[model samples]
Target: MEQLARLEDLPQTYIDHLTQSNLVPLWPSLRNVLPPKQPVPLTKATAWHYRDIKPLLLEAGELTPIEKAERRVLVLANPGHGLENMKATSSIYLGMQLLLPNEWAPSHRHTPNAVRLVVEGKGAFTTVEGQKCIMEHGDLILTPSGLWHEHGHDGDEPVIWLDVLDLPLVYYMEASYVEGGDVQQVQGTDLGHHYAKGVVPTVHFVRQNANFPLLRYAWTDTKNVLDALAADANHQAPAQVSFINPETGQDCQNIIGYSAIRVAPNETVQLTRRSAAQIFHVIEGQLSITVNSDHFDLARSDTACASCFAQIDLINRSEQPAYVFVADEAPLQKKLGLYSTRPRSV
Candidate 1:
């Protein structure tokens, strides 16, 4: 690669004139925008253990009431992007949100799309687009852009869920904002279970008001499918299942992709590099993961981030089957015509 000129090489007088007109030359930073092989990534391989976060999250509960702290959450910010940015990757925003017993998070709609992965506790439910979708352990729920969603807890213990949003990208585009509203009456229950594997209701796949058909994906159903897929493959490397809209058979949401993987006991699987950044949250058993050079021993409820084109290896250390929830930027990348993956045998 040819050496690019540094900004300091430019004459001070020329720099001053360009500064006056708010114009900056790109030659000096050209390589940064267009690297030799792959694009430089600000997302880092990072981990957020639930063990460490639970205490602090509980403290937040004691520190303030739900009214004062709208979404009581501790953002899982990637250091490479600066912690203040509250981004897990360039387009993904992650946070550990807490909803104490009897507490309610008011109804509000935002321009950015979001999803909630149930981490701990239950009896918490999210009412999205007038449907009350119950939040259970390992369940996946979506709050699509421009949809009113609110959370409430009816369980005796506190409930915590991992919040993943396309906030960074939306905020960057200057289209991020929220509008509050009164509680919505439950128009219907979770419609996810209404449609089974390879089956869609002819009566009405979804209610008329629902633009994004399915809202809640039960872990039970997902686990059953994962186990079936793995067993059918005779406990092959690793089994994966994606969450998608039952109607269109596309990703559950357009901005981000959600999936779950089941790694057989004591089995190891290597996932080839991809252009999209990825996140892993262990839902069951323990996981030993290697992203590039960084390695993480993830226990249940532990979350980790990996940069773009990151070589990933997942090893189930426990005797029991290990299940992990995965989120990635593939959908958005594919939409932008930048999605790429290179497979490598282990």
Candidate 2:
């Protein structure tokens, strides 16, 4: 009778404390405090929902506040391991970054795939998979999952780029692993020695020589590919290039996926109908993006998004030429027939 009364009274105290504090109170019988019921662990697996990033729109001929902010490479998200602001499982994780002159971010590596889209400035380089690639303005450099890479600014001006990774999935799986690079940098400053010297030969998966795994994509010849695609009438998608396995011509990674973005001067592109949420970083010039009805101006180092394909529209305002980096999980979402975009009424 005493135990039964205590059980009823103990719950009453817990409930009273919960209502008063608006938080879950611990029971003396438990080893640790219990979290709120809303965040309780699920018995069966549940599908995670997509989240959108609010966009920051920039004006024509205007620079982002980061210029005056006087810092290099602002981190958009780094909320611990499991609590990262962006999801890495169901979709790709994209981050906006700006690096001023003379700044160097140390070398590091992790399990998720990553890429950098140079937004502005020059003289910044990322060494990936042993290859050093000068992250020129408008260049896209990829760091494959489990590759060691680092960023350094040796240029005269600040360099900004978007950091996209498959962080959410790794975080959710709780398989997060990280490590520092083997050295400060390779012996050479150029970003070519890692693979050109035959030290790193292509790995073979089958007799077909298919699916060559590579980690770097330099901008030196990428622009030419964009030009060729622009000249081809059959190719309508902007920057519609896929990261292929160098050996097999297969995708570099599976699941969390890819995007193609190349903006013309003062051009605004409308997406067709996409369902996977995407994060966009303004690579060059200034951009005004309208998702559904709301809009935001984004300059270099600024980010915007269309949550799970909630209707996306983009307009470039810079004069010199503009580029944008878009990250999405279309590879997975499209497989489920959930990736598409409808033009929102202007």
How many residue pairs collide in each prediction? 0, 31
The alpha-carbon lDDT assigned to residue 281 of candidate 2 equals: 59
lDDT of 1 by residue, 1-346 (tens): 9998998999999999999999999999899899898888988899999999999999999999999988999999999999998899999999999999999999999999999999999799999988899999999999999889999988899999999999999999999999999988988898876788788878544475545778889999899999899879465556998898787788988889999999999899888799989999999999899988899999999999999888899988778999999999999899999999976535
Q: What's the lDDT for all of these models? A: 0.91, 0.56
Give per-residue CA lDDT, model 2, range 11-42, as digits (tens).
67677877798775344433323443221211
What's each prediction's TM-score? 0.97, 0.61
Q: Which stretches of model 1 miss by more than 4 angstroms? A: 203-206, 234-236, 343-346
Q: Best lDDT goes to which candidate?
A: 1
Q: How many clashing pairs does model 1 include? A: 0
